[model samples]
Target: MQTQSVQKNNVHKKSRSSLSVYLGQWNAPVVGYVFIAPWLIGFLVLQLWPIIQSFYLSFTEYSLLDAPHWIGSANYENIAKDRLFFNSLKVTFTYVLASVPLKLAAALFIAILLNRSIRGISVYRTLIYLPSLIGGSMAVAVLWRNIFGTDGFINNLVVLFGFTPHNWIGMPETALSTLIILSAWQFGSSMIIFLAGLKQIPSELYEASSVDGAGPVRKFISVTLPMLSPVILFNLIMGIINSFQMFTQAFIVTEGKPYNSTEVYALFLYKKAFGSLEMGYASALAWILLIIIGIMTLLNFIASKYWVFYESESGASK
Candidate 1:
């Protein structure tokens, strides 16, 4: 009888322990969801709902006034035939391709310079980063227009140098390039990231390379480049995404003028939705942009596996 009683007690203890463990596991997910509930709700309401709605609208003809009429693939078909759509796409592609590499390179160079132990380095860093904060504002865009205007600072400088003055922003040929330069000038945010990445790299690696008779350039190429590849990939992807979505600078400075030479994808979409009252078509354009960015980011992630070396994993294997 005592043996049976002890066996029953052991079974009860095991059941209790199992129940407690199950409750603990359930509590964790509950707590995690509670903490994330606000963001999740906001995302669904603000971001996800709009995206889904836009996808549905992309197949319809809705002018934000009347009921939406189902148009199937008509919008996509029209985009293929539209010359302005092609022009806007060309302009956006040009900006992304031209600006991203130049901006990232400039950022990396400045970051390297700032990473050095120099006097008043914090002041220099702050000054460099200030442009990024101010450059995206409407006021700065107005300032950019003045700086590149026909009778503005650039032309004045050209005249001072004994050259005939030419319209910079007023000309279609130079207008887009001016915006590209403006974008490159605000490389501070990327520079800050690069500086942080540079700091994270172990100094011992450089020392070891130097001990092996590696020069500065050689050390950079062999040691620093490999370690910084992940950060570079991150910056490259983000820069491309941001560059592709550039709108405000061109919108404020050029107003898509000079025969719509500066009408980027975002501006084109805006004009379609607000200026022309074609919200359905604008939704299609937004989806297309999203797809392009998604594909590019995916390609970058796939490519990074070959080059990006994580210290923890790579060093462990070595």
Candidate 2:
């Protein structure tokens, strides 16, 4: 009887221990969920819901006024057949192709210059970066429009140079170029990233190059380029991605004016959604844009294997 009582006591203790452990395990996840609940809820309602809604709406004819009516792939069909849609694609492709390379080059060049230990370097970097900080704003876009306008600062400078003052944004030939230049001018973020990459490149490599009788140009070609390859690749991909979304500059600066010469794809999508109240069409366009961006990103990654060299790989090979 005493042995039976002892066994019952042991079983009771074991059950309590198991319960405590189960509760402990449950408590941790519950606490974690509690902390994450707000962010999870916000993401689900705001971001995820809109994204899902857009996907669903893409198949339906949705205008803010009426309930969305389901139509199957009609929006995509219309976009493919639209000439203006093609024009927007052309403009956007041109911008992405032109601006990204130029921006990366300019950013890298500026970063190389800034990498030097100079007096008031931080101030200079700040001044240089300030434009990019404000570049996306409506105010900056207005300033850009004014600067490139017929009687604006650029024409004023040209007038001083004794040339006929040309309307930069008024002409088709110069309008897209002006936008490309504006995009390239906002390379401060890229410059900062490049500067950081430059800093990471070991000074020992430079010293070793010098010991091997390498001049500035030779060392730059051999050491600097290879060392900065990964950074260049990173900046190139990001620049391309960002350039594809070119909108505000085109919106405020040109508004796809000069015969739709500057109508970037995103701007066209915006007009379809808001101006024409073709929410379904716009959603379709958005999905197409996402696919295009994904393909481009994939291509970049594939191409990186040929060009992007890592220090780890070098170390491993050696």
lDDT per model vs. reference: 0.92, 0.92
Q: Which pairs of residues collide in model 2?
A: none
Residue-pair clash count for candidate 1: 0
Per-residue lDDT of model 1, residues 104-220, tens digit only: 999999999899898999999999899899979999899999999888999999999999998888788988999999999989899999999999998999999999999989988
Q: RMSDs, each prediction?
A: 6.2, 5.2
Cα displacement (Å) at residue 267, model 1: 0.6
lDDT (C-alpha) at residue 127 in model 2: 94
**TM-score of each predicted structure versus truth:** 0.89, 0.91
Q: Which pairs clash inside model 1?
A: none
State residue 227's C-alpha deviation in candidate 1, in Å.
1.2
Error of model 1, residue 89, in angstroms: 1.3
